[model samples]
Target: MTGWTEYTLALVAFTASHFVPRIGDLRGRLIGRVGRRAYFSVYGLLSLALLVWVIVAAGRAPFVEVWPQAPWMRWAPNLLMPLAAVLIVNGIGIAQPFTLGGRRQAVFDPADPGFAAISRHPLFLALALWSLAHLVPNGDLAHVILFGLFAALALAAIPIFDARAQAHFGPDTAPAFFRATGLFSLAPLANRSWRKRNGGRLVKRTAIGIILWAALLLGHTAVIGVSPLP
Candidate 1:
């Protein structure tokens, strides 16, 4: 496709992915209309399809390198991506009260000490970091625009979603919710909470994240067919 076509497609996909959830309490409405299981299935399928299209289109778009990356920015991904991975793993593995599992009282308690000190939304933070890191290295118009859009969405969606969540759940419930998942919201307080809860499990996840980061750094050329380090 032409550059304009590629840019348009990328923008459309990114905007749809970010803005769809904000449409008229669509998430709750979907759950109420189709039931949880069916809603999740449909949502997941549509998201996956959009993601696949974005990836394929990104690969086909002609890359016009905008500028030479600084040494620091090029290397920053090595550090940030690993941290991002750790956050993602911890968010998935930890039974925090802000998560669906923890919220339902399935695995952890709301008043648990660990859950009380950590941000509930580590996964979103992880994704945000990954997007930001890539935005630094990928200087092409399409790449910058696409990754930049994700970074903006990840940052913006946190507070908007948090407010909506608090409204739906309750004002009294906000503290625990914030404590459990505030990291995802881009609040300084949440970062402090996350640091306080940095335990052995978090360290182990960091180690795993390091390994994943190394793999990505070494394999970026092959997987993405571009030498990021160059």
Candidate 2:
């Protein structure tokens, strides 16, 4: 299929994946109408199907250069990928209470340190970073569309998810969530705080980052049939 055809299909899948979650808000009514488990099962399956379709479409689409590739940008992804990976790992390891997906506790504790001090949604931020890093290097019609859509989704979802969380959890929870996890979303500004929390763990984050960088460098050519560094 043509890149345009693939792009269109990807857009549809992406839109469905994002918009489907919003319907969960109607749970009370929907669950009342349909069985609760049935509603969730259907929604989960639909979301999974859409996600798989988008990934498949993205993989099939050929890269069509939209702009001149810069030598510097080639190096940038190599640098950023590691940071993105660390954020991803931190998100996985940390028990951030502020994020919609983070673990919820009965009591709030300020001393609860983790990736929360860096960003409320480190995982989401990592995804955004990874998308941006790849988009910069790919700078092609298909990649531009795919990564651009992903970047926009990652960014837009944060606020939307935060709002939904506040609505569901109450106004009091929003402030703490914002305070704890907001920093991770913006790395440069959170450096001081991240250093304090991570301290000796910075070495661990760096090691994880290097592993991620190497994995991407090695895998990009095989997976995409193009060496991003070259």
Candidate 3:
């Protein structure tokens, strides 16, 4: 249907919008033109607009079934969602040199790297979890496109981040950072208790995550007109 076409366009636009801007000097040039703060402000607003369009278009697209919804499907998010949220909260809450403007903060420890004890790229991990958690139960063409794209991009980012780190931090610091961090679930390497070091932030962010997830549970029907709860 016509909505399928719209959904496809929206998906393509969403991917291109984020990627194209950052390809070369385009983003830097834009930042120079508009000033960094204004550029980010505009970028944020534009990205939000694109996201809304994708969601709206996906909602309207005629359902093209893939697999029949499994009875056990809803449980996937229930189990993994909190972990994803926690990772994201812990990841971004710290100053990660990989993120935009974060290198300026100089918070990435060659020794610890905070939650990088679990994974060097916790934000990417969180995103992949979030994408896959929602995508599996979705089982529709439009949503498959949307969430699959995100999951692929997030997973791909892990390696990309590593490469960027090596380049940016140089041969010495980067190698030590990589040695300290694990590609996945390196909690075994954690030298001390993370809970002790960042207990307050952990409690606060997890509580906020719970509140947000609860709101999504209650309001998914209202917002998307589909009950996430089976």
Q: Model 1 TM-score?
A: 0.71
- The residue-by-residue lDDT of candidate 3 on 148-178, one tens digit each, is 8889998887777778888987987777877
**Candidate 1, residue 229: CA error in Å?**
4.5
Q: Could you tell which candidate, 1 or 2, scores higher by lDDT?
A: 2
TM-scores, all candidates, are 0.71, 0.71, 0.87
> Any runs in candidate 1 off by more than 4 Å, and if so which?
21-34, 62-66, 93-110, 113-116, 168-173, 176-208, 228-230
Per-residue lDDT tens digits for candidate 2, residues 26-107, read 6567777897678867877877777667666776777677997888888767777778877776666457544534664524
List ranges where model 3 is wrong by over 4 Å: 100-104, 184-195
Better candidate number, 1 or 3, judged by lDDT? 3
* Angstrom error at residue 57, model 1: 2.6
Q: Ten residues in a row with the worst lDDT in model 2?
A: 104-113
The parts of candidate 2 lying over 4 Å away from their true place are: 24-56, 59-65, 97-101, 104-108, 164-177, 185-206
- Deviation of model 1 at 191, angstroms: 15
State model 3's lDDT: 0.76
Clashes in candidate 2: how many? 7
lDDT, model 3, position 67: 71
